[model samples]
Target: MQKGKIGVSSDNLFPIIKKFLYSDHEIFLREIVSNAVDATQKLKTLASVGEYKGELGDLTIRVSIDKKKKTLTVSDAGVGMTSEEIDKYINQIAFSGANEFVEKYKNDAQAIIGHFGLGFYSSFMVSKKVEVITRSYKDEAEGVKWECDGSPEFELTNVKKERRGTDIIMYIDDDNKEFLEDYRVEELLKKYCKFLPVEIAFGKKKEWKEDKQVDTDEDNIINDTKPAWTKAPADLKDEDYLKFYKQLYPMADDPLFNIHLNVDYPFNLTGILYFPKLKKNIEVQKNKIQLYSNQVFVTDSVEGVVPEFLTLLHGVIDSPDIPLNVSRSYLQSDSNVKKISSHITKKVADRLNEIFKNDRKQFEEKWDDLKIFIEYGMITEEKFYERAEKFVLLKNTEGKYFTLEEYKNIIKDNQTDKDKQLVYLYATDVDAQFTFIEAAKNKGYDVLQMDGQLDSHFINHLESKLKDSRFVRVDGDVVEKLIPKDEKQEMKLSEGDRLDLTPVFHGQLPQRGKANFLVTFEAMSENDSPVLITQNEFMRRMKDMAEMQGGMSFYGDMPDNYNLVINANHPLVMRINEDKEKDLEKDLKGMKSKISTLDKRRAELEKAKEGKKDEEVPSAEKEELHDVSNKLDELKKKKETLLNEYGQKNKLVKQLIDLALLSNNMLKGEDLNKFVKRSIELI
Candidate 1:
């Protein structure tokens, strides 16, 4: 036996490894297993080059846990390290000092490890002591035993003969004895090594012998050596990709479609990206796409490697070029990673385009499920937007799908406003906006369903991208005003009469938040709803955006403002106007005369005091002006109360307010119940 100190400038190497180098202690299994896979791959490369003459039989790596012995072992039959090789690779710690190393990589622990090749050292994180028993493939080499506690000292000695492979035995520390359990080790292996290139065995296969599970001699492999992504597209059927997806996410609904990513020119990247059926609020399940380095699992939090939008996809992405690191930003900014990202985006867009061109009906069938991803891509990636324009689908409330050009063509003649801007009408809720949708359909217009989580931001993006086009919510205005033709009708009511009618209708409406409603009149076809509640497109869109995104939180904090648009052509509004003209015309005129006199007196007092100091202004004149203003305001109130009384007796005013409230799906709780009862009585 021989003993030597580890080649390190500082004795603090083991402490750093245990506390700071790796993010999680459980990753030790992944690191050891990854090292085993690398050794196996190296042997395969040598055999391919005709350097190894031995049989390459059963290249699976085996993991076994001995609970009684408190030992966890990872054994691999591959190219093993000889004594000299072990001295160079394992004994030497590569860093100047712990502080300097940490300062250089404080923000990104993974970058330091990935760049400097620290895979083997991670084993020390979980083990109190570790032993490597191995025999090199060289003919004259004997098996060697290397032992090291969590320190800078290690031992190397000759051992009994063994196969040309390595077995890493980790004596689980007292604090981390959970690793000695078979289930714990098995779970870690499955999570990190499920899609590795080499088969990984956890234990012997179990069979239901005599109605009880009993372990067999055959190895129970945990990984698929040849996942669907590794196979050629020509060789893979659609069902095969879906089967693999189901294996990855057993509880999820079937994926809409998949993009097989295989590129070599710019950067080596191979993976299958599945478009999941994303409906309603888009909950970002981070780390859904596993990033692998040469088929060994590195991480699932591949935010930097994959485009932010493509993170919604689920599958495996194996690339030797994408270095595994905790700081995804560093990985993303790497030249090879950037190239790979661009290539993946192009490949995704191309796949969608191909599907649309070849089998449009099928593509349309999956559009609802695929819209969220496509819209997110277009919203985030400029190049992706450029390519996806042709294939991105617009789904209408009629359960039909169309490309941008197709939908624009369908609605151009009927829905274009007087300014020649093409109006693309949309509805967020089919049930809630049913009235608006029916109103649009009544005018021979189509309403697309822009209801996805990203649709708010996406519509804004499309408005900027599409020329002379605007997306208007179906409830944005009365159908006639929504796509305004070239005509304006004059309001026939006097100013006094308009003032009288304002409070009558405003008094009956329910108040919510700081809601402000402007009572306006529009001449429309009598068949349209007598009252329509509409919001400005910009404000509504901003508010919708605020619901999904931050930075515009000010818009979200504001109350919803609506227009209580009363149709003048409808009989109910016409009768209300006629009643106002009859009941309050004289009183409103008298009040207006008094108000004008009071305003003149008050203006003169203010005008007289313009250049004068407070002492110079007469108190009598100020008191007289205040008295006049108070009398004038009282007279105006009397006039308003008379009109409000008249309106209260008129059920048409209450009916209109209720109708508008009901249309917005805002009349709820007891108010909704009252509205339903009132509606039945009115009908």
Candidate 2:
């Protein structure tokens, strides 16, 4: 028998191991099972190198729970430890007094025991006492037993055992009695060891015989010794990858495609990344990609390992180089992690490029489902953007797909303005912007559907990337100004005529939710609608962006700015302007002539005061100017009121405004009903 305090540099090592070394106490099962697998792997490696010349017997790691005894046992027929090895490896935790180790990680408890190659100590987390019965795989080796009762002291002694293996028995603490449950242990095994390279068995296979279930002689193996990712890519088919994806996500829809990542040089990394059929919501699809270390499941939250934008992908990423237990910050800054991230990005880009080049029809068919990923990548990662631009597709409103370069080539000759800037017109809603889209189509221009959830931010990113190019919403402005195909048409109406006729349409503008309408006139073809509404691109994009990202909520709070543009050359608009002048000219004439005289006097006073200081200007002249300004403002208001009354009486004014609103799908409820009733009578 051997009795001695476990050789530890710190007296509080046990407390630190049990309380601070693991973030989740339940992960102790993962650590212990992982260690068993590691041992099994080591034995396999030795046999491959011809170091061990004995029969390579069954190597299944077994996990059993004894309910009555309140103990959980994990046994492995692998490279078992001798007494000397137990003393040297298991007892010694650190070379230093380890005060620095304690001090450095005293406050932070996220550090896992497995991180320091001390995974066995994690068993102490849930155990009141742990027993290890191990015998080395040697001809004359004797079995040995080591026992510890959640303290620095441990007892080791030789024991009789016929088998060459190790068995770890953990006496569950009173507070952790749940570990003794068969269901609990099975769940932990499936979570942590589901895809381990070595076989893992829990309990025994059962058969429904007689009236109920009965245990069979066959072992109930729980793990897939060879998951699909561990195999060579050439050995896997499309169906195999899809089947694995389904295995990972039983309830999810089939993935669009997958990229098999297998790289050994510089760092060992192997896994399958599936491009899931993402929905409009980006957050719901995150955390689907699980990270593994040498087939041991580490974390599904792989934000720091994979790029943040790539977390939407589903499946597994196993890399032996990545540390099993690491702080997110540490993982983000680690050089190996950075290399792995870049490699993954390159692999993804290459895969996408291959698909796009080989099967363009398939790529186009899947473009809608695939664009969100490409767009998000382009928006977040610069290198991804550089690579993705080669295969990135732009979908048009007519349901056609074109690569960025292809679309640019098609539109550069037609959509480029005199300023030499290529205009990429897009629409959010095809049905709502149907008129604008048709107008653009008629002008030999194309419109894209930028309806994805990420499109707002992606549009901003593309504008910055594409040289001398801009993205305009199809309804962002009048068609003439949107592309400026020809020299801008001169406004047919004078400024005074436009100002005098503005109140006619302004008075009839219907109230919509948080909508601000500015009545303006522009010259257009006589065939064009007399009135149409268009939103400013910059203001609308700011509001749309505010909805996607949270920082610019003030833009969201602001009213939507719509320009109620009147086609001055159209017959209806011309008639309306002429009628407004004919009806209100006599009434406003007297007030206008008096206002003109007052304005001229006020202008003379403003010019007189321009070069002079405020105090130097005569007080009598200031009073005359102030009086003239007040009278002119009063006269203008009265003239505007008369014109407003005329417009309210003219049903044509209300009908024109409603027609423009209806064309834009903004007319609703009672206003639509009145427009319908008035349209019948006017017809």
Error of 1 at 624 (Å): 9.7
CA error at residue 377 for candidate 1, angstroms: 1.1
Estimate the TM-score for candidate 2: 0.92
Give the alpha carbon lDDT tens digit for every residue of 1-683 in model 1: 97998888876577777666666888888888877887888889989998987898888899998888789999988888789888877876557776677566644554544321366777778888889998887777899999988778889999985588899999888999889887888888888888888899998999998999999998899898888988999999988988999899999999888888887766688889888888666768877988877676777777777799999988888887675443222343576777787888888889899999999999988887788788888999999999998999888998988888888889999988999999999999999999999999998999999888889899999999999999989999888888888977554555655576777876675677788788887777777888888999999999988987779999999988899987767767777888777776787677778778878887887788799888887999878868877887887788778777777776778878887888888788987887778788888
Ten residues in sequence with the least summed lDDT for candidate 2: 324-333
For candidate 2, write residues 44-77 as lDDT tens digits: 8888999988887899999988888888999999
Query: lDDT (0-100) at residue 388 of candidate 1?
Result: 92
* Candidate 2 C-alpha error for residue 553, in Å: 1.9
Q: For model 1, what is the C-alpha lDDT against the true structure?
A: 0.82
* lDDT of model 1 at position 94: 59
Those runs of model 1 whose alpha carbons end farther than 4 Å from true positions after fitting are 98-118, 209-211, 325-332, 490-496, 580-633, 676-683
CA lDDT of each prediction against the hidden true structure: 0.82, 0.84
